[model samples]
Target: MTQNGFEKTGDDALDAAFAAARAARPQPSAALMAAIRADAAREAAAAPRAARPRPAPARASTRPWAGFWRALGGWPSAGTLAASLVLGIAIGGQQAVPLAGLDILAPASGPLDEAAVADLLPGIDAFLTEG
Candidate 1:
């Protein structure tokens, strides 16, 4: 039964057409299947028995510090940085700044010091004219 809007009509033509179409469906030929199987077999036989599987790609980290660590070559980088830090601390401790022995009151006999220019500052214009 086929219905148009609210009206219904008793019809068997639509059902028969669908049944006929379904019965006429095509299938793959035997030759096609044989060719596909032959290709698969040939490829399998040609493959090396001792062929190694490919290694999986390294997973990159999403953390901000991960890039920093990776750039330093991971554990080796960390060890180098640690060694440098330890050596720096050891050397620094051995040679300390001599703040206590600094003599600010002593004569500034060195170049560009106050004592070096003190004697020449009073007669600055006379010195300049003489030059």
Candidate 2:
């Protein structure tokens, strides 16, 4: 009996046939191998060539303000900052009273009256009397 549980009939003809089949292994013909090689060669030739890597651009060494300009978020942001700075300076330099009409720095007509001081500090009168 064989390993696959096939009983050995002891047939010489069948045993010879199996031996011949195992010995004659199928292989690709030379014509098929030549055609495959031709196809591979054609595909490789038709494929696009790989591009060479380019060197990095050289940095500007002469311009010192280039870094500062870039840090300020380019031209639009720099222009805005400059305009804001100029407007702030112009407004701060003026002596005009603000919209609140309470300029502590402005000269007064005379000494502060009781009512005026009381208005400024609501609980000041009671604290002063207790003291």
Candidate 3:
């Protein structure tokens, strides 16, 4: 089942397209590769190093909105805060509107009946109708 018995050879380790099978030849030491590595190391070591130019310092922003950015770090914009405050005031007005003259809901409406609520509710018609 092996194609040229290369499968048992494991991976593509010996699958050099241009080279003949090892059974027909002998491997040699990689003296050529060693010479190439040494040459590259010598060239890299002997090369003159150039100093990198320092970058200009970051300019301090004078924009008025910069303070707002610094204040919240990354909070919502001023218009958003104003809009939220408006929405809060609008919703708060609903609850406040239900109250009479900004006074307490209890005293302004009068005291609760001391009688049990069940009795009052069940005989509500009679209690309210009767003097």
Candidate 4:
């Protein structure tokens, strides 16, 4: 047993094989080493060049409204705002011009009787009942 307490089986052929392996120091061939170095150099050369410093883009407009336009999130946001404004005006001024197809979503014509209300909220009656 060695200092690590590993017990070797007393087989002469196996012991010889292990000793041979320990004595053998395999090394890469010179040609193989050269090829590897060449590949590494080639890869380093082919690597993309450090990004070039880009010139500051030219401003398309210097008008005062340009700053306001940017603050309002550019043209896309302006389009959305215009649409919302138009929709708000249309809905707010419904009496002036009725929106088409809005009548279908209107509430039913008759008054909400007790039976109709009960049908709408079946659990409400139980909730109101005292224990």
Q: Please give each candidate's TM-score.
A: 0.44, 0.38, 0.27, 0.33
User: What is the per-residue lDDT of model 2 for residues 17-101, given as tens digits with 9 covering 90 to 100?
Assistant: 7666657968889999999999999988877665434566886657888888878899899889999999999999989756565
- Evaluate model 2: give its lDDT: 0.77
Question: lDDT of candidate 4 vs native?
Answer: 0.77
Instruction: List the global CA lDDT of all models.
Output: 0.71, 0.77, 0.65, 0.77
Please give, for residues 6-62, the per-residue lDDT of candidate 3 as tens digits: 445444655563235555675555997788889999988877655435676888789
Alpha carbon deviation, residue 98, candidate 2 (Å): 6.7
lDDT of 1: 0.71
Candidate 4 lDDT by residue in tens digits, 1-131: 54235345588787667666656968889999999999999988887765545676895797989889889999899999999999999998877766786654444686556665687689878878855
Weakest lDDT window of 10 consecutive positions for candidate 1 = 1-10
Distance from true location, Cα of 122 in model 4, Å: 33
lDDT over C-alpha atoms for residue 43 of model 2:
86
The regions of model 1 sitting more than 4 angstroms off are 1-36, 47-55, 95-113, 116-131
Candidate 2 clashing pairs, residues 3+ apart or interchain: none
Clashes of each: 0, 0, 0, 0
Error of 1 at 10 (Å): 29
Number of the candidate with higher lDDT, 1 or 3: 1
Q: What local lDDT does model 3 show for residue 26?
A: 58
Q: Rank the models by lDDT, top first.
A: 2, 4, 1, 3
